[model samples]
Target: MTQDLFHPHRHESHPKIISRLKRANGHLAAVARMIEEGKPCLEVAQQLQAVESAVRNAKQALIHDHMDHCLEEGSLSQQRAELKAISRYL
Candidate 1:
């Protein structure tokens, strides 16, 4: 990936991406607390699911932003290669 592809838009979206990751971090901390507090299995599972979803959403947001702003000006081959590399997460 070209650094220029990301540098131009990084300032615009970096903060939002960081905020999302922080939210996910908080959710994970809550999950840990719930487990320590001996919460019911069902409740704990629900919170874990929420944490997982939050993390997944954050990852997807980052990937989407990268694709939109960074990949838009790239060659088709580069874009395809990047998409292929990220496809495993999908």
Candidate 2:
């Protein structure tokens, strides 16, 4: 949906979340490089797993931030809608 709905306040956690995502991006790039270099399957797989975990952690942090800020600011119906939308990511 909308970025404003999920990140209405751009809370303090925003920078930390961005840092996590940047790390994930770096891991993904390394994975691509490993594949291109014909690295061993197991090694590549491990790096890929790291990238996945990093991205998942970033997503979790973002959702937690959204729940903290968005839920507090909105009405009951709005909160319910936000929760429903957020659940899809989980």
* Local accuracy by lDDT, each model: 0.80, 0.85
Clashing pairs in 1: none
TM-score for each prediction? 0.79, 0.87
Report the C-alpha lDDT of model 2 over 2-79, residue by residue, as the tens digit: 567657657799999999998889889989999999999999999899999888988988998788777865678888
What TM-score does model 2 achieve against the real structure? Answer: 0.87
- 60, model 1: CA deviation in Å? 0.7
Task: Show model 2 residue runs off by greater than 4 Å.
Answer: 1-9
Which residue pairs show backbone clashes in model 2? none
Q: How much is 78 displaced in model 1, in angstroms?
A: 1.8
Question: Candidate 2 at 26: error in angstroms?
Answer: 1.0
Q: Give the per-residue Cα lDDT of candidate 2 at 1.
A: 29
RMSD of 1: 2.9
